[model samples]
Target: MRLLSREIKLCSVLVFLFLFSLKVLAQPPAHDPSKIMRDGDRYWTFKTELGIGAISASNNDFSDWQSEPSVFGDTWPSWINTYVPDFAGHFWAPACIFLNGKYYLYYSCSTMGSHVSAIGLATSPSLNNPDWTDQGMVVYSDGNNTATVSNAIDPAIFKDDDGKAWMTYGSWFGGISIVELDTLTGKTVGEKTTLVGGNHQDIEASFLLKHDDYYYLFVNRGLCCRGVESTYYIQVGRASSVTGPYDGWRTFLQTNGRYIGPGHIGYNEGRLTYHVYDRDDDGTAKMMNTTLDWSDGWPVAVEVTQDPPGELLPDGTYRIQSFDSTKIVGVANNSPYEGANVEILDFSDDNINGTSWVINNVNLHQYQIAPKNYINLGLDVYNCVGDDDANIGLWSYWGGQCQKWIFVDMGNKNYQIRSALSNKPIQVNGTFESGTNIVQMSNNSNDTTQLFTLVLLELEDTTYNQYPQVVSYSSQQSGNPASNIIDGNNSDGYRWSAENFPQYVVIDYGDTLSISGTKIWTYQNRAYQYTVEFDTDIDFSDPYIVDRRTNTSAGQPITDNFEPVAARYARLTVTGAYDYTGPWVSITEFEIIEEEIVGADELTLNDNTKIYPNPVVDVLNIQLPAELSSGADLAIYNMMGQLVFRKTGLKGNIELMNLSNLKKGIYSLIITNNKTFVTKRFVKY
Candidate 1:
């Protein structure tokens, strides 16, 4: 009898396991999941997992959710499967909203390669105990006589800042589209709007959200299936209005480290959540989340710290600077160690791999600083010529003991540095004195010797575009002065009246400059067409056309990048306006820009001194052919000309200027004995 009871218990357990599996399968599918909507404190959403039908779910705490009936409810009485024959049994995308005590669910009923598709809606009173009632078809595209030009899939809704309702939909068949919608009926109104279309229609799965004054459009690009092989990811563009001619698409979520297929996502409160396939976990698509920070008013994903896997520092290249010595460390090009020498020199502005370090965190507060060029070859820090005061250079990054570094945050964005290679902290060895070679020593005296700060290096054009010798311009109308355009002010844009055709402004860059482009700012969306030209003379003799743009609609200040040319004179010609009133042209601010060529910018000399390895790594060897007084002064200045490192009473023939503590980049090195002094350029790797 006991054996019989045991068998019954095992059978019961097996039955429960089967039921649990079914419940998990019944939840909304991962591909193109619906954006969650809030019903008081409870949340509700829909998904395209069920074919030709949409699935529903609700949760009060967001941790646990219970699946509800199909969004079409009781029975899908429509012949949607007939139109979407290829994908007859499945829905593509779904979106939900809670408005006026009614939960409205919208979904795309479509098939592969068939233009005959439709977006339909359903209404429910209570999302938790949903009894969805069909609201009939909202929009459809048959690709027949005068039917919709869009594919009628991937629906997203946007409620404008002013409380107006709009819907965005469509897929590969045509392009992502938008249309105004009635708030009361949840049905589209007004003329169908073609937001984007044609061969550039390599996008789908649209999602929209309004933050601050901008409306952000998120879309999925590339293929969606194949698990680990899926190339799918999310991209975004933003505009000031719900109906938009969005700008270039930027990767909303970048792939590479851990996740993949970050598509068909949603937003809630401050966090953006999306379903992603884990490349390391055999492509099991799961929900992933991230917070955002504003970059010049645009959203950039910020990684949060989680234990175990790789914990990365903020991504970007940097120049490691020592707080004590204030010099940068580098691989010596002048007095190189046997393979790649170690030395210290004044900081430089140029990004040289041997000097520039690519610091990536292995875990929180721990990182591996690799040379930029070496990183490309998969080389990291290794005790290459292994020994005490070993030859440290780039080598393949495996799980080696010497590669790990611990950055001790010493308040105010500074750090007290230590390494996993040795128990001693990294000190600007006085061998330990001023201008001393940096070496890792046993825990000795505590001073500023081991302190360091990572300095950010500008990657943009470093070549300064001369601010023009004279502000020269012309205009036909009154009230607006021609100087306003070249005044370099945006307080109020330049305006004109009693318009002039072929309105033009001439710019004299003071001296000859290699013209590349110009930054034009104007009254919002007024400049429809404009042209830029460069020449050596104002007559435009040997005129070189820089760039011309027609139908310019973007309100943001326009950036026109062109091939660099040598010219001292550039001209701006306004040809037309989109919404022109009478014959008038208004120019706000026009500025000339120059190409930042690698070798064109020479270091300004404050004096003259000889320093070897123009771009030095470790030691900035200074050898004066002449004798110097026992009491001599030497100093290093950064690009900003700020004094960073200095030494007094230096009496020597050759000074081994220890720069291992300075940030990598260009710097002005100065030396003086008696009344004689010299300043010259030096670089730290």
Candidate 2:
């Protein structure tokens, strides 16, 4: 009866969605460009633009600088070979965390069978290292014995505030499941619990995060992996515990203007958000889509804003309440041909507003012509081509005829197209050259005797059928010799060594601190020579070498203990190599635990203090009982260390400052009046 019910439900879904049973094959489509997002200084996004299909990882390897943005758009560095060999596959759904000085990247891979789906683990001391050690399969589900769905994929790992490690995974199964893990070893420790289950179709690519004592579970639903037909969308539920009978299941797509199929919720800038799995300009299925917002209890489609407590628009969009555009200069088109109409065709919507002249209608006759002539205009013409038959045609009246035939100012200035035949209005001899003379001429105003016809044309794609490329490095170099090779490998003189080094931890002297302990981990049978260097500058030269240590031992973990020193920056230099080269050593983790030391010192100064009302709407008022000292600095910094305001001391009893420019977040106020230093924290709401 259960089998019959399953068959009946499948038939009903097919009928409702009007899906055909044509033995469809799920293959990576061409022109899959995923949206890219910025995480701090590094850009993290799925690599679909290169048309390489679903990329598993971006190969960020220090030794292999070329490994970044992995050849096939996979961010996973090639270094995993140093640890796991069965790591080869279309591995995707990467969740990375920096814990205990090591980067743990958890991802999943699958072949044709649902039971074959498995989650894998890889670790690297650095994100940009080619040396990733595959920790092997963390979990696997075969359809025969496991749950209804054999696909055990989409793994997300997180450590709670209490120092407990947890992983949530599963897809097309009953629902999402949460499992506890042994932190020391990436192995499951507790029994898997069905956190949430329902009749709704849930393909678990669950992202579990805690906010305000609530654990949020984000899951993907409906059909996914279909290029244009993928009904990928996101839903959220919250529970007080990691493994919960989560309530408040809300579908973000139910909102207006809300796009379909948002999946893979990732924390961006410390906020919960999901990726939009939608069609690209060419209608290709893209795994890396735009970001969605989850500020409110329910998920809303919103833009990423640096400001906290931003507003959610009526259309479910986010507005950066604190963004100031008054200081920005508006883009103006000064060229005479700015308003001219240019016919564009055959190009995908992605390239429509770009600078490239990718036109439709591959045939020469179908090319688009500029709406107006390039008579008088000073503009930059980009990828447009000229007509072979005409010497002079319509041109804008700009300084040079070429300038008249300029492309419009598109964002990023990459897809602009200009007429190819525009020439200088004034001839060399103060006379325009008659027909067909513009051909073979350079940008010479003195040769104005040559009249030119500006014509629009398109170019063909050159990188068709080309597989992603990677650089092969020679193993003879040592001590990060590859670091010098910033560009592509060319001259043997061009290649440099790239190595991973440990970063030092430091504490300020102003704070009374007592060092409790220090821990370090060295991976593989690697010997390392460590030197403690100190200097104000981070340069290698002129460093004060404080201490050094060398380990000739060959084995697995190594531990060292030492006393702590108060310094601004600690420098750790490794020498002896391990694994692949000479004196190679990779430090997996280094930590320094400290405790606060209390002291008793008495100093007092009498001064006037004044603050405004408890609640401030637009402006905040500050008053002083006495005139402030000259040259004193008043500054306001946000929680993220961004300076929002700075001013000098003024001789006024009361000061009115505009708080409208500030975002709804916490800020620190530093006022240096006379010789006294004062610091206070305030909330801007």
Candidate 3:
């Protein structure tokens, strides 16, 4: 009878184990919705609680959305210390870009009206599920020098055709500045250059776009974030070169009402245009223009104008036959007049020929009623670049060298305006106050000097039939010829190539071996699978049997440690790879070293004990020491710290009841038994 009872007991235990395994597999996986955005396509939005002031998207539209973290019930990272606890007093003006298959997000932190702000970088593999790796303080503003605010904000990155990287940024402090960047090392290569000055209404938030042959400079003018009194608006100028003397000879201005602000420009498909900025009366929430058009070299707010084709006159000019205008409601057009009238004009001696035009009675300058009646010649206004001592004057004529600017459309509201003379554009210099003088200079093309902003203007009847001209500059190869190898060179397999890595190498071993030393060697113009052989004989055929590494494309030597291996013939094999013309695995000499071996099992945990309720249905009893007092408390935490259970006044044991409501998973328990606190990890089955 005793033997039969034992068999029955073992069977019952087996049955319970089977049921528990089934329950564990039945639960669904957790869902993470934090990275999803409203736009269903190639866009995403993630909430960052670094400072909690404002949240701006990588898309560069800065009108609406309070973007505060506290309002969204988000908290800052726990690692932040008490010194700058409010996270440097709020994060504002963020920028992001994708480089080498990683997403780099840059942000600014500082208080209002202070140049103590700093720019930081965080990296992730994907916009969703972004494991933000914080790269602290790439640049900081100087607190001293009242005349020049050193606040470093608004970072923009541009990669030239030659693979060289540049960053442009700046605001209120000094004007805009640019710095050449070493993308591989995340550092600046040379001294920074002051591109544009803060003079002539150049304020916060600047962007650059390369269109055709010009680098267009876009900047925010007037006041921003001032409730209903915000004078926020955008202005533009261009140059034929990256750095320049960006002439505002063809500057476009807009006016609606108290609703006047900057417009966001972007390129859909291959068309270059702008998005109208729409903000609520409170200036908190903002929207965008619904419709898009590009006939006038400027985008109108949600309205489309269609004109019929006409024949050219004897004077080599075409007349605008007819046009229709419509107002985009809810899209705040501050114009007192509800509708705009269109007309075509023929200027006899003007170089401007074969262009459509629309005349508006709106005043551009505060002094003039209608000086020259704001002409939208349908030609992009390119900023200019000239020498510091060069006469960078703006003229109305189409001839002089200073009047030339290159217009490039850099997809999303970003542009690059280059100068025809110096092949650069006009850039903002120190981050000084508004009305600081703007200057023409070389193309630093870095984010610090690139300016981005919005512009609000009425559509005019002027449309140039001829597109702006652009001059192409040849891309040149750089670096020492002996040190650097081109892509197709078969001399060195490890030479720099554009191929990306599939997976990173990881080290694993069954037993603790002294990893005192290891080294890898490669031959010229060939690839090899170099690895440290240990224990058994090296087998190159079996991928899993041998630990191996491929040559790096950076053309650098690699060596590591693998010690105390009682084996001979430490050889490297030429595995399958590209550019393998000869035996690439070459070893001049191999050395063996004797070292101490440490085992991972030698590690231990002190004063900590974990418990578990193996087939528990409801209550769980935690065994404690007899020295525990009645006032002792026991706190229980789930995997996510939802506080599933808690108790006080424990004697020799703690009884946790009413646990039938709990789910099956891992849990952490903290028991304070008579001043001897113990943290225990357990599982509820």
Candidate 4:
């Protein structure tokens, strides 16, 4: 009975292998991951590890995962070492796709920081029981060979709507390039076409996706592999076809708080997969997933704001300096009283406390500026009047329109701080000496007194607001396009006007948002009857309308607040004019305001709880109130809202915690129990 014994042993080995793979792994560290593949009830994805490791998820749960077998195990392709001879046992940026009932996996093989690389291919029938057959190298790069000199790495395969296959591959040496491939053989059939160049030589990791009528190309740029200091971010461009002339390059994702860098994007099954370096956890790369929303025919990552390169002023603590480098904005004589005059003064150590200001983002392209020593008082225009030469003062926060400010980027880190109430830039009153009063004035193209510089003290956690963009409009006059309405400018030269009665503009904020109101600034001070409509779809089918017809007001800016509604696309239709009945309609700026919603789970401030040495180093001491003397739950989260430390069932009022292992960044300490919930911010060095 030898045959029967052998069969029993073989069956037992298969059963053990299946049971071992059932253990779920929490947060499997993956880098340069491929688009997830599916086999029956299991999902599979490959990543760059020891010769390309694979992971799987079962029962339709995409987050819970288990480590699977490596595609080649200890035996890699034999032809890899022949080309460059610096081949190692590791791979980089693997990509996979299914074609003709077979899976084609493409990967990169290269040395560190070099262009002598190659892109290889392998095929398998089933991922659940993989038997990958090496198909040799598809493309390579050489220093001496003129035929294949392009740095070939990060191979991403895409199947067009017409059922033709193509591969997009390259690295820093030649930016990103693409070539057509035969669907049957999974090999290149045409000459490679260079798609786009990188910013310097810091761009790589290209991924291509086809949605609707356009082909979107995603790439990574800036420094990488530097832990918390990595500047890697994602950029996107789109073209009508799969090949040349890809324009409209825009920043898609960026470093937000403890999430240092987000790159290497893959799309599958209505969701996107990428990796972000977690600064709270020693800058480890972790996998992240998000969905997409369309705004004006372009894809925007859901719930993520696009911080435009070189133009965005992130929320933080800064010192406001005028065009004169030695002078800065401060309270007159360092006064702590409300309604104190804000004046420009010379920089000195005694007046450093008055120069520190906290800039908080209130809306899209808007901020609420306040002194760091007194956050309750904010910069405001006196009397709330909308006119030129309005004096600016430090006043208590009353949620007035004059307290809200808009920062207009004038390039080179210089900004024109404009008032939201008057749409006028704040100037130094035509003087540069000490104690010069700051006032609001008319727009001037070449005024240095109006431009101010923001010197950052530290990078802090910032909230996000989805960027609203103008996508479509009914009609526009020459030299004044529809996009000027959302360019964060209210000047007369930057406006959209048309010689028609029924001209309209549509703005897309990417996803469905809780819209509360609209701030419309027209070209002239004329009364106009308009109707605002909103819809979740691009086409205004079954829209929520806010009709403002039969109105009689001639205000420059008409602020209309309505019932909160969920919408994605907002349309403003100018029906008729009341004061001047002419065939002309113009709009200078349009802003959709979001409604703020606070929940009961929010933290409540407690005066009894005191934290010592706010900019603490190594150790942190927390003195809890008498109400929290009993057992409580303590948690510390990074700026990206990621929990880095948690201790449950903590007792006593004075708690001494060691934080020597944490990185140098900002953190929020949260303490909660059955009867108490408190939160505080501290710095770690």
Candidate 5:
């Protein structure tokens, strides 16, 4: 029955165009992964073999990874051969913990499937510094009496809430076992006791996590190291005490479609990291990450899809209600065009058109908000300004900083919607009223005026380009050349830093292209003031100030956007750090964003609309169908669906619109009336 059920589940997954495969990305191969560790701004996870391979990611994003030099780097500690005479350089299932201002890394040493194994320890002052001091064998098994002893492999360390430390180590030989460890010396302190799988069940790689009142034990079951054929899955059990007769073990994670052999669970900050056989990639072992949803007492991994374009929110229809519960966000007079004032209004069951909004998730926790009345227009900060009390309004959705909002969850289904431009939440001008204006202001967490609740009404899917190519880059600092900013590594040793104030870095795309925004991965999480400028030519004769930020408290990878502009060069000038008083400026990585281009096939429109002079410079003529001529409205939006031009109450089939001041780019012309709606694509040169 179990085998039949597994086959049926696999068949169902194949019918959905392999939606489960969407969660997998091109990641470096990793096996027996260590618990993810954080060093300053980077995340590190060690793997088995290849000298204890160390892999890292920047800004806490595990989707993409970069490999650092291995810890041993071909030099093995001489003491390993003393235990297992034929011991190779390969170490397995490393567990790392930071304690007392130092890091202790424990690794398993032995040949494959051998009971004559030993666990060794290495200490380092810092992860960035490769000065690992080898501490000889912590524990070992002779295996001379094979049937009576447990194999010393896959060591996992757990520190209880009482500050007492314990080590759990073993494999399939005689079952999993646990022993107390001295936190000061990283060594065993008491005798070992067998826990589970007494010489019968195929179990290994055990890990323990304490949450609330339970100590949950996680272990791998079934065969491993067989590539695509491996059946390794994660099983978990829980107990009330640190050491106990645990409850019945149940499957926690198993193979899903192309993600086969999910094993070696490592957790950090409510997120789980493991390795899986990627059937799609020739069964290669790859690292996988997911957030843990503990709402149901037990932890369940939540599948995270690929990041949306920039910081757009997930595609959905929602009701945005203020914390007062009586008020919701609405457009003034139900207007559906640019510059329409957004305000808080009394909730009404029949006011769906005024209260409901369409939100598109881009990346991280940020989203682009559009009203249901006109999904083409987005919620905007007036004039793209980040000043306090900046009025919030409705504008064309152009993927600009003014339209993106970060939803900060404040518990109880309440959130603080902060503007990506100003890093402030929309608050009532003074007090809540029937038509109180909403303006961006500094956050006061306790203020009810700034909190909102989003009730999801519908769901949709959208994709975006996360990172565009950077052909070349230059910076003002020579000591740490700006070239490091585009080197594809965000580790501490590969950052661009300058001790001088007003330092700058320039990224050149090698060709003039439509760019919407850029994000900076700063050296550290300190507040920095900076200015961004864009230009088509290398010379600054006609530069456009895209964004100028000051007094910001945003964390690493600070993101900002501007209206889509045709430029080949972008410059970031660091004015100062930490209230503009610090002298040094550092940056690890700089990403340039390309404007999002939603294809015409993605839109539903009448097929009769026509436009001429696609690459128009001064004037654009539109030949609309007779049905849409009179009493109709026309709106011109950029590639990102941001409204650039609009007119109402049209009266004729032939409408001539002048776009002389518009920049060169692709745009969509949308014409609508009470009954007919159509959209046509054009270009402005």
Candidate 6:
């Protein structure tokens, strides 16, 4: 199962729509977009006005960005347009959040030059499940029409270190005001208090950051929203409390080069993500990011380094969890049937019983999910329908297109699973209910029910019959010692080499077993030639040369397969080198392979049989006097009688067996499972 999630396709469509609207209206969506909110490392910029398009960036880098599908429909959720006719339906200065499995987007809506604006809220559980519902207006300015009580637009949510949340919003009409927020629902909980005010000429965009013992208030001052002519710049002030008559209102960041209107700052980690009107490009707003250099307790913006998007798992089984609740997503015992439902639960006794999922990659980080135990079962579309709200279920795998899924990574390790067949998302039918069945639904915004996390599991081990024991080297160089090769460390610093040509290393396997191949890793330098040989005797009296390398050197691990040979000892001898220093042999890792046939060895088959080529190199001829039995077996064993190779079904009078797959060694051949028997001895030389 693929452990990767990102909805690049959905974002592309959203960007196209935004660009299309820009063409029709002949105007940009929002002027100088506001604060950047990040979930884990994923970043977004919600444009001000109407549809409030949220564009995306990677590694918090806004360079050449992405746009989420626009919330189109007359540019605003239809539910609120009736309440505020003069509201302009323009969603602006949006502040986003993921709290309790829901995304609370607090935004501003107002007409041209009107302090009579409203800060409305929208809620979504999954970013990929774009079902953003308006939570109605939070708090808008209703006081005297003067700058003192000005409450118009520009909203910012400040979450503090103590878990308390507050909001600061307003434009030039009234300065900035702070209000406590209801923790359960991100809306105004009590009356507001004024923090700072000025003549409606130079103030707006309040961003709060809790650093050290101070709450730093950042705001944009002067005329904004005039495209390349906008003169807005950011300034900052700090207080020990959220509401305050603060100090140090100095320039935070200003227009540079082709950048203008540098405001609406959001601080994460040590960097600040914001936007600016560009005189370059198309004279539209572009996202800009930077870290900060601090001096005398104030800050200066420095250049930033962006990171690439995250990667998928290296390929393995993993347990899927609900990112919102930390619960495991698994098939309920009763739900393993075709029409059964899937659930996310809080407890588990056995992970492999049903929790393990096999990830079959479809493409581009998308995968088909199946249970490890129920190997043929997959997440499927139930009773298949092409309309809205189709059902989801687990069923016997028939390789249907509906079984494919893609994960969209919501920041903070959360993922939304979308079907490759329907292009819809899967979400728990309800809230964090322990055993809710997952259903397919359309995405509008963030919803907790649709999120999941893929976690890794330990791998099972395999057993080997024989392995290399003692290693003897002919000679070694001073710095490149022979012992380094067998140390089991392939790091650059550890390796082995022979100082002179005609150098060799002898490896002894404690007992004789059929050796099939050897794997080797060499140093970076390409200058040596070598050959591998095996023999039953230590001195290699009649050594069988297994493989050879003439004059080239390559770095990666190389595997050379040969005819299976029973050898207690094997040797690698270097014959030549081209290094300027001298002829030297270097190796990082060397592995010997033992070939074993599982249930392939049988000594007898019904009736008479004759075998030719006592010592074979490529093909051995087997002759049968009459027709053979259905289950007739052919197996070869080494001198030690260990089954090395075998095949089922024997027929025809003259049957040829390819001996090229076996290592050169003395061996016994057997044919027959029951009824009758045939046995003989042969050697692959």
Q: How far is 399's C-alpha from truth in model 2 (Å)?
A: 58
Across 183-205, the per-residue lDDT of candidate 4 in tens digits comes to 88889997888787521133578
Q: Each model's TM-score, in the order given?
A: 0.43, 0.35, 0.35, 0.45, 0.42, 0.39
Tens digits of lDDT, candidate 3, 1-685: 0000001100000000011121111111100001112222233322223332223233322222223232113343333322233343345555555677776666555544445556666666755444667766677665555224434766666666667777666764466666776776555678676566432113445556565566666555444443232344556667776666665322233323222343323322222222222222223212231233333343333432211111111111122211111111110111122122111222232412222222211111110011122221211122322344232222222212233343333334333333333334434434333322234455454533333221223322221211111111001112211111111223343232211111012111211223345543334423444444343111111121234444443232334554244321222222334445432223222233435323211112113232436335577766554434356676765432235577887764445455677765444566554324545554455
Whichever of 1 and 3 has more lDDT, that candidate is 1
Best by TM-score: 4
Give the per-residue lDDT of model 2 (tens digit) for 297-396: 5555454221111111111111111011111001112122443222212224332222122221101111122221221222223322222222222232
**lDDT tens per residue, model 5, 302-395:** 7644211122234568888878857888988888888999998876766678789877653234566888757667899998775789899997
Query: How much does candidate 1 score in TM-score?
Result: 0.43
Q: Point to the candidate with the largest lDDT.
A: 4
lDDT of 6 by residue, 18-75 (tens): 2211111112233435455565456666665446777655545454456667554456
Stretches of candidate 4 exceeding 4 Å from the true structure:
1-27, 59-61, 144-149, 198-200, 304-685
lDDT of candidate 1 over 498-589, digit per residue (tens): 25544555565533456677777775546546667676544342457744445546464677777777565676766567666545666677
Output the worst ten-in-a-row residue range by lDDT, candidate 4.
Answer: 1-10
RMSD of each: 21.0, 29.0, 34.2, 22.4, 23.2, 30.1
Write down the RMSD of candidate 2 (Cα, Å): 29.0
Q: lDDT of each model, Cα atoms only?
A: 0.55, 0.39, 0.36, 0.70, 0.68, 0.60
Off-target runs (Cα >4 Å) in candidate 6 are 1-34, 38-42, 62-64, 75-79, 304-685
Give candidate 5 misplaced runs (Cα > 4 Å).
Answer: 1-26, 304-685
Better of 3 and 6 by lDDT: 6
Evaluate model 6: give its lDDT.
0.60
True-structure Cα RMSD, model 1: 21.0
